[model samples]
Target: MGLSRRQLRLLMVSGFSLFLMYIMYSSKGDNPSSLSDSRESANSIISANPNAKIDEAINNKISKLYQQEQAEKAAEEKAAVDAAAGIKVTEEIDAIEEDFDPVKELMQIRALAPMIVFSKSYCPYSKRLKKLLTEHYEITPSFFPVELDKHKHGKLLQEHLAKISGRATVPNVLIGTSNESKGGCDDFLNLHESGKLATMLNEWGNKKLSVKRLETPSNV
Candidate 1:
């Protein structure tokens, strides 16, 4: 029983129409506005139609976007950590005086240079070092007691001296003579322990006295 060519053609057309109607109905059944709506629809279509290229495209885009965002976030977090690590904290200075002359002080006593001790009132090491200076040696007014908390001047002075002397720390002790400047509390202690502070002071005083002799005009 062979069907006529016209009948076969008509039957094929009907079947194709049914498939097209099914495709249209399935596509319209789900909303396409939100990601979740699209994802659910994609999943349903993929399960039913494994060879769907359109669903695979959408998934690839989503995965690529996720990876890019994760890398950017990781970079930002690393930058924050590096910034925290690189941060430097400086010691705070309270106040600076309006009229404080360093030159006049330096010139007096024929340049009888002071052992400048940068100090903070609450610092125990500074206190102990000061006590040691007083106990072991003759600390004159030239032994400048610079309080870092009381004024910024002390901190500035300490910084200036540090740069000139090639060292940086608190409780800094300096012995500036007519010709040379020696640094550090430990150095001073070493000299003092070795019975050298007295000798050095005497030598400095003698040098100043000799300098005065050179400066004065002899009554020939």
Candidate 2:
């Protein structure tokens, strides 16, 4: 028996609705699985052909640079302490002969005097030198951090020391009471090796005291 037109239309509508539901269900169920598969594929690619080493190298260099800078700052702080505590400097007698203001001249002389240093933040030898000086002499001396040549006078000082004192190294040292010693880390070590560091320092300290006493006479 043939169906009526309204009955056929109603049946067609119901079938179409069922087909659309099935399509929607299939899409929803497959999407999650498809996404998971894609993620897994990407992970495999990364694992098989890793390319982030450049990033690691860059990061390592950055970290190393930061560490170096921090170390330098620490050394400078130590030096500042040493300087404030009184490290003597010596200048050429003839260099400032023309305009010798005793007050200012004395100040410059103190600044240019021989100083003992242990280490600079940027120099490895400076570390070793500092340790030796501390262990052998029990003095920290004045510290100088020659990392980037921030003090323009350092060049001139280095040149002067090189030309006059014949020593030109970051850890170079001058010892004795009058600040007359001119040597470096090697010299310090040599003195320690010879068991003369302590004796020399004592003698130098005595001389230094006497000189200062003479320089500043008492009313009595």
In model 2, what is the error at residue 97, expressed in angstroms? 20
Indicate the TM-score of model 1: 0.38
Error of 1 at 78 (Å): 33
Show where candidate 2 strays beyond 4 Å.
1-115, 118-120, 140-150, 176-181, 209-220
Residue-pair clashes, model 1: 1
Residue-level lDDT of model 1, residues 13-67, one tens digit each, is 5565555556644773644888888887778776766345544644565566567
User: What is the C-alpha lDDT profile of model 2 across 1-220, one tens digit per residue?
Assistant: 9997557645655565556455433433435457777676666645644335434544565566567668888999999987865543323434544343443422354464334342245666766776655443433343333432543244555555454445566665544423333466677567666667656654554444121112222121
> TM-score for all predictions?
0.38, 0.36
Candidate 1: worst 10 consecutive residues by lDDT?
209-218
Number of backbone collisions per candidate: 1, 7
